[model samples]
Target: MIVKYTKPGRNLIMVPMLILLTGVSSCASRPPSSVLQPVRLVQNESEKITLLAITNRDRESDGKGFGSRWAAKLTYEKYRFSIPSERKSTAIVYPSKNPDPRRQFVVTARKQLLDSELIDDATSAANFDGTVAVFVHGYNYSYQEALFRTAQMAADASTLSPPILFSWPSAASVTGYVTDRDAALYSRGELERLLGALAKDSRVKRIVLFGHSMGGFLSMEAAAQLKLQGRRDVMAKLQIVLAAPDIDVDVFRSQLRDLGHMQTPITLLVSKTDRALTISSVIGGERPRIGRLDIDDPMIR
Candidate 1:
């Protein structure tokens, strides 16, 4: 696969890293096994899609639903399935002739696996390709939302080798902004542990960290934590891509200062016109969020 790069000043932004899909995508909702056909047509299309997830969200309804609070028990789940492109027209994966909420696109998933075995499975998959992509979701996201979002990103891109999700409990409500912020901060240690696990896994060659909104802050903070531990080797093999980060500019600068010189290249994707960020700016004492970056500002320069 050919990778593309765009450099704006010192920052190196990778194109087509995370393709955000908008719609009714759910991790719990999966396509059936009938979608996987016996024939192989296009080599470009994915044969199988798998996402390894690490989460702090509490399980609900006897593990049927995922809650929005941080749990002391760190759980891991592996989701795998074939895409719509891989099979003939099934009511699953591909939308029906007429839109039917009752017949929504479903991608079937394998039985859930727990514990370090999740890491082992991901590492084995990476052994052949030596590449892995780690995705962190923004605030106001439930555990399943984060899972499906990352799944869509990985499947749609078709370029990402393997996708892994690091899900922190986000309260999943607009009213829980303060609570979510605290939770994001608290998740730094687990993020560090996840990153360190991937970095130390000899089978994995490179890691790409992709973060959106509050997840971006967690990504940077986790990187800072790793740096403080003198894990330059891990940083060397990592690439960071942040989109519309809801980070305070001052805090971001301080995190950068703590990081000092970094081996990993961080790409920041921002839009000043984002109305949600505008509200965040107001709530944050009129200080512009890092997502609404001023490129000309010497702080970032």
Candidate 2:
């Protein structure tokens, strides 16, 4: 089924860095253009899968395409998505698998001119429950990694709600940690725009904001921004989940004080064995990160 977008609302100002589209092929026969890769691919075995992603990384001019799978599929063989550091917001549809090499397969792809209300309309139309889970990735993640992770997590959860990925411009390298951290901070405004749109949409009944590692920092920041904007109605319908958050204990405590007691439940998932956090602790002058807290400590109690 081809999903189309209606007119976008006037208030939607946040630009979606990437848009993904997915549809099923009617026949089992392999497409003539299908090239077998040596390694196993995620979703390679599945006949149909739902894919949705938004990314802000610079586009590549090479044949490989953008960080998003659906965007890569939709982009022409040249594989261009967005320009390097282009701030113009865009939304595009996924390309269907086509067999003919001679004919262009991606010409039919179109931008999803959208606003939050339009997004809610589409989500409401897709599922009766009207729940949308937004997943934000942490530091050192390439755009593709974030996209695939969200897809896999959503599949594992087996939820009726659609999964959306909000990927910042992470340097995607261990050495780039500092740069990624700054990028994460810079991304707060964009995140706010996205969350605000989703929150304001009437058709959206529930929203789950999930973040991993440094992404947790972004999530909490966005949550605080929502509260500051007097968008408690939006916060009321949200459920915040932070997994292995890479946040300073002091910062976390401050965020809590500002948020006060929230109507929405916030679930924090932490583990001592998280090596990344272990290294982070060392970098931060031996102070324990929030993700690696000691519950027995009186301060924690």
Candidate 3:
């Protein structure tokens, strides 16, 4: 006769069984699309736009150093801009000894667009007829990468009359995350200076500020600073668009509230499948803030 073996207690068996089931189910299911895809912005519609881009020089150099020079090499290929070799002395003047050369380059590009009269100027409220789109790029982007992205946006939103970019120092480096954060803070003053200059132009009626990844945090800070300085008057002239911002959802909302409840309409472009943001979240020891929550989240709402 065979002897009957005694069974383990329910509590011990249940937990292990559940875990095994969960593991099997997870293995059976496909991973989320965002897990497999890269993060990118989608531009559609709107016309007569100006782009302001904030770039990270340190990021560009890092790509070069690491021999992954995709940002530097592929910048111009993706966007249409007059290369230095193709540029005339009258077309644009390069900055000399600027603290942030990337920013200077972006400014120079904007000036070229303005000088060419390819896009209208925002000089008065009555002159506001088109869109002014400003882009603040995220971490680890090189100078060329930023330029190309700006150009690509311009091309994608060809209907926008004049696009301007606002470039900020990102100090793009993997190990320099802290330094980059500090740098972004340091550049707030410059952003404020730029906003002051833009607000004086009455022609700027419909302004769109687009900030991506970490750039979103910097953009929000800059906007808040502008509001505190009574520069909120410019809010009447603009719309704010944030894409995959790297700040905490709560922080973003609080800042908006402090800025007079976001006097202007705000749009957030979000993608849950952004690997970069995922990595950012992990490093920061926080949950990822995806675009899906932009509407329902109380903080952003």
Models 1 onward score TM values of 0.77, 0.67, 0.58
Task: For residues 248-280, write the lDDT of model 2, one tens digit per residue.
Answer: 988887887767777655666655656667766
Best by lDDT: 1
lDDT of 1 by residue, 1-301 (tens): 1111222223332235332312112346443223321223323334457778888877764556567767887878777644544332222333333322232323355446766677677766533477777888887777756665565556556644457888898877666778988999999999988888888888777788887888889999998888889997678777787777788978987887877775555677765655546666777889978777766567556
Query: What alpha-carbon RMSD in Å does predicted model 3 have with respect to the real structure?
Result: 18.3
Candidate 1 Cα deviation (angstroms), residue 82? 4.4
Each prediction's whole-model lDDT (CA): 0.66, 0.55, 0.46
Among these predictions, the greatest TM-score belongs to 1
Better structure of 1 and 3 per TM-score: 1
Error of 1 at 239 (Å): 1.6
Residues 1-301 of candidate 3 have per-residue lDDT tens digits of 1111111112321111111111001112222212111112122212223443332222323232111121221111111232232322222222233212222222222222322132234332243455556666666544444444554445444433435555555444555455656766766776666555566565555666766667778888988888777776666665666665667666765776767655555555555555556656777787645332444456634
Q: Which ten residues in a row have the lowest lDDT in candidate 3?
A: 16-25
Q: Can you give the lDDT of residue 119 in candidate 2?
A: 59
Candidate 2's TM-score:
0.67
Model 2, position 229: C-alpha lDDT score: 79
